[model samples]
Target: MRAAAGKYRQRNSHAIWRAHAESASHPMSEISVSATSTVDERPAKFSASDGTALTGTWFEPSPPRIATTVVVIVCGAGIPARFYHHFARYLCECGAAVLTFDYRGIGVSRQGNLRKLKSGMEDWAVLDIPAAFAEARARYPRLPLGAVAHSVGTLLLGAAPDASRIKRLIFFGPHTGYWRDYGARWRWLLYGVWHVSMPAVTKVVGYFPGKRFRLGEDLPRQVALDWAGRRRPELGRNVEEARRFRLILSRYREIRAKTLVLSITDDAFAPPAAARRVLSLYPHLVVTHETIAPATLGCGRLGHLGFLRRPASEFFWRRAAAWLITPNVGDEPKTTTQAAQSPNR
Candidate 1:
């Protein structure tokens, strides 16, 4: 068993290395990472409920007014929290405290020789997200909290057991029915590859290289497994977990917080119809929806992940700032004060 595992590991590792090399040789020029402005503040590392240390940066509002509310930025599959740095800073500048963190066993938080087990989206919903939310609340107890989840993070957040902690929720490019949109054949093929083959391959090969493991880039084996096997609702991390994509559809009605759903018209991962379905689930909740055009934003045929990548990102941040600061009864009292103070107009 050990020898077989070793061989599989080596093969998968080599495959990842080759892909990484190829990507490096011909890097895509869609968005330049350095193009966006940087946040001057450095992130502080903190421990989660499971004792896993996580990295996060807190953005204090500009002009340092008394903070009215705080925003927690949750990134989607495989991405590090650093990708949301620009957005977080924009929220802070608009007078809302912002906290962005890397989920456990991914990004910089993967340090300390953590075990590489295959985890599903359910694990994130049950363990990582809840712990992160709890930590954010503990750290900023005095301030009302809002959450902005992107992609897979949206599913996990939407399924959270304690949605009351969040005053307002925003979903950016949420993945409502990924498997269906990708086609049944593709879904089955992925299931066979990721579920039946990947775990066995990973067991034999010590670790899968970063690039081949996309969703939670550089994700641990356990996380990858959870993501792959996350078909049945019963297989989710928490017992009360919403089972299946249909369950997610139904649970939206239970989300008590004011919500906003944002999607790009050209986003392949989340089409306009999918965004509409998500909103439809929450008819009673105060909801706002917007569709961004890539051409107008100077983003060429931008899709799901483009919102954070580059030149087009300015528009996304601007929209986010407006949505977050706009005074609704659900907004923090201080948010109203900060909006009034803004001299940008």
Candidate 2:
């Protein structure tokens, strides 16, 4: 799908990333404790299959012992790993190790200029996502793997070499990129932003300056183009030279994880219609499709990017984490069954 909007009071958040990066290390790094004092955070680095360097962070239970589960946060199109920190820490507190990383040419993994970075959505799906899974498996062997994919992150999940290793998955605002599927009222406006103006602007700047437009971080030229050009309901391009794209979608069948596809009522970018199209691609998985109305959660509004943000997290984050640690997906967790109960305060 497209990059989500809504920064949730973000102000120089990248500086926080830089502050942590100053003391980054291999596998492990300097630790910082969350306000809850129930999670331990550390910086970690790894490389993609193509030897392109990537950066990530690990969130573990307060005492920092190895956990029985690892939930990798597959970020959306232009958003960085930091956007999902709230969700990651919640997973950690629930006794699951969480891994959140920036895709190539994004956030901490960004190198040089993005326009020169030749990677596109396909590169992220095949090279980067697999590498992330590999890194997680190598670091935490034999533990059950899970993922929380947001927006285009859902598309990236299929081509991962370790897709079968994922025992549970949560598709947050998952959608197949079909412009017609946008919510009725805001359809044209969003289409104008993502499909029309985005490409035009990216063409001039040599990248998608998403932050300038309040649409998450800037993206590589091809990443924006890929998002813009994929107007069809399908996963990838439909013409010739797309054999590789077809090959990537073919791997969708490999993912047999129990999944929960969350379609936010207020998420015009990813209505249930659009999210269902993504679900259609994964026929082999045991899946549950849930449409969450803001009123039902008493949050007033939870947009495409709001699930992991405040207000919503205060009311819903823990319940979502509860699903990841459930025995239905993996082995027993160190935390109590209360972890799976309703997250309402």
For TM-score, the strongest prediction is 2
What tens-digit string does per-residue lDDT give for candidate 1 at 215-247? 436666666555555444232345554445446
**Candidate 1 local Cα displacement, residue 256, angstroms:** 1.7
Can you give the TM-score per candidate against the true fold?
0.69, 0.83
List ranges where model 2 is wrong by over 4 Å: 1-36, 329-345
Each model's total of backbone clashes: 17, 0
Candidate 2 C-alpha lDDT tens digits along 1-345: 222111111111111111112211321221223545777799979998789999999988765455779889999998899878767877777779999999999999999977888788878988888888888888888888988899978877887877878888888888656688788889899899989999999999999988887889999998888888867655546666366666766677677777766778889888776775666666576665567777665556668875765445543455567778867543323232111111111
The window of 10 residues in a row where model 2 has the poorest summed lDDT is 5-14
Best by lDDT: 2
* Candidate 1 least-lDDT 10 residues: 1-10
